[model samples]
Target chain A: MGGFFKSSIGRKVAMALSAFFLMFFLIIHLTVNMTSVFSADLFNELSHFMGTNPLVQFALQPVLLFGVVFHFVLGFILEWKNKKARKVTYFKNNGAANSTWMSRNMMYSGLVILAFLVIHFADFWVHEINVKYINVEPADPTRYYHELVEKFVPIWRVVAYSVAFILLGLHLGHGFTSAFQSMGSTAGRKRALQNLGKAYAVIIPLGFIIIALYHHFNHH
Target chain B: MKLKLKIWRQKNASAKGQMVDYDVSDISEHMSFLEMMDVLNEQLISKGEDPIAFDHDCREGICGMCSMYINGEAHGPDRGITTCQLHMRMFKDGDTITIEPFRAAAFPVIKDLVVDRSAFDRIQQAGGYISVNTSGNTQDANTIPISKHAADEAMDAATCIGCGACVATCKNSSAMLFVGAKVSQYALLPQGQIEAVDRVKNMVAQMDLEGFGNCTNTGACEIECPKGISLDTIARMNRELMKAHI
Candidate 1:
């Protein structure tokens, strides 16, 4: 309903729904990227399929992009509104006395993630788009693996990605259970869900980190 | 214990406020924080100076009228207690204590260390009650049997004192915990089911209209709450709101 999107709870639910979509996208992306560790042919095959498939490029890609933009725009708006709620500042607020550093500083962590996203898009997506659509270059399935490995060969790029992944871990550390809590989940399963969230936060980012580090070292 | 105090002082709602320092000596550690304030006021009155104004009714902590951001906390450094219940022993001799009003756009400072909490009352008035027929025949109270678990949880939600500590301590000044407690206390009961959808929708609408921030699930409210009201109540309210939409 139109009214639902206007309310605070409704807006929170909308944020949570977008977060869920983005989190799911991470898993698929990581799985595909992980294939590069084993065989170049397999990685190339998967990359070519994902990069050129009509369903992916034309349909799901736009939805994913929309979800990312929607999440960030709404997040910034909510942060701005929250800041306006308190006109006067507290002389001394001990926020750590009651809440986690990450929970309170979501906007900052999200900004870091946003910065990384730009670099990520520039390094890979823009190039992919140019190769496929703009330049209309001939399809070379083997080009995918070499390009990905080459990106990780630079130390600065590897370090930047590693730092971004660590912050991503921190972002998901709170955001995972937070998203569920926003969905109105009951307390009975809270402990289990939080544990699951912790594991996910660590594993997802660690997987990406290992892939980055592995490529940086093994690109002989 | 002898201590230095820095208290916020303002002439009126529109006046500029500043922290004024005062020294109180020969104080006993056993005295309640408010009693120490009383001593300070006594000293001020004898000096022909105006006493710092603050809010407190039931020193026993049930009235929810007592509010002070003491030393960067809602109710001093102690956990699960209001300002009136905080004892002087929490601070040491020669310690300088800082006291200020609860800061929120919705809770404007009226004078020295006192804020207008009428925003909470308005939110409650919006939809915090259930409809009951009382003209002729009233329904028997014992007719409905509620599970013990539900009854206890409802009672827990009912324990919110409306002290605004949750709002004061929250980084975003969000009042979700307070509104959530009000909504959950009723949504759990069959007596409250008839108006359930409207209750959540209206209360949330009023809460937003009052300039309270959206909850980011920081869990600060639950930790700072005197009643230890859980974040589950907030989740329940979210669920209720979602169900209402559906």
Candidate 2:
């Protein structure tokens, strides 16, 4: 592990593996959220199952949280290491002009996404656990979950979610292609992998956008 | 053809720089980009204003001295060609062309359009050379036959002219592609294998010490590179570094 962290390939592999974990979570997340557009009853049922399923809730949730934390930690460490390698200062010049806008701005975008996550968890996760599991809402058991979706229905909320989702899409687009290349997946099928990346760049954001618009248009 | 030029001007490294506009008329379409600039400088001198100070030598584009960020793209808008090779016909009459020095924290402005790319020289000095003494008693040309594939790849990597376009085009200001090319050139050959580990480590250390950013592999450096050196070189370097570390 120390040897891996010391080498450039090792750092890249760490980043790629962590990113893979996050991508897996993204697929599961998008699928679960998409169910909300079909029926609130079905979505609620799924949410209830997710909440009650001991195996998934106990085992998977901790791993997912660990993945997010580890990914972020590795990203910052690599960025800092790169910065430390540079020695001089220039007056007015664009540095590393060949990288994507998303990759370059990942640190900033990741922070923004983190802020959104905080608000997101507070508005939904906290309430779900507090009201449903804790038995705090004596009068209204499903009120918190319904209110969470209601917040998403508003135009401003919809716009906020859309913007966040777009950032995620941009991050994933570059991250996907980068992960493949980092893992020594060069030549032949690499082109196919990059194409799949480009497709995901468009599709995943579109998925989030559709879900946002669906609730915005169909809900109150 | 006539063109309006907005060229950056600075007295010295510490001085503030600004874009001073000049109009040149009847420029021959046959003139190279540097030649057009020469005409503009002559006009500036005749008008009693200081000539726009820019770097150029061996206007054949081999010197890697003609560093200019023309119209937001390094070495103007042409692909796989240096600014010296870019012709006047690429522009039209009355076109407003903006020319500035390549921007980077490491590449300080020495004068208008001329930057102190000695940092690159320093990086090269760090470990870019193979220390072989040839006192006219060296081995024959066919003594060691390098494979055609390895020789081609080495030649491709050696094609890098140390122009700094890769750094200019990179968003993070990374010099990985440039350094990678140099490292790959030597790493692929038997002559370079003796010091492969030390060569990569020293060169990469120098590159970082020069304040270049990390590589994100956006392919922009390749696109804007006058030599069209591929990002694959950087990937190869990364692989080499990984092997050395392990």
**Candidate number with greatest DockQ:** 1
- Over 4 Å off in model 2, which ranges? A1-17, A31-63, A66-112, A128-156, A182-185, A209-220, B133-146
Highest TM-score, which number?
Answer: 1
| Per-residue C-alpha lDDT of model 1 across residues B3-27, encoded as one tens digit per residue | 9999999989999999999999878
Clashes of each: 0, 19
Poorest 10 consecutive residues of model 2 chain B by lDDT? B208-217
Which residue ranges in model 1 land beyond 4 Å of their true spot? none
For model 2, residues B12-99, the per-residue Cα lDDT tens digits are 9988888888889869989999999999888878899888888888888787788888877788877888889888888888898888
lDDT of 1 at A212: 92
TM-scores vs. true structure, each candidate: 0.98, 0.82
What does DockQ come to for candidate 1?
A: 0.87
Best by lDDT: 1
Task: Give the CA lDDT, 0 to 100, for residue B161 in model 2.
Answer: 94
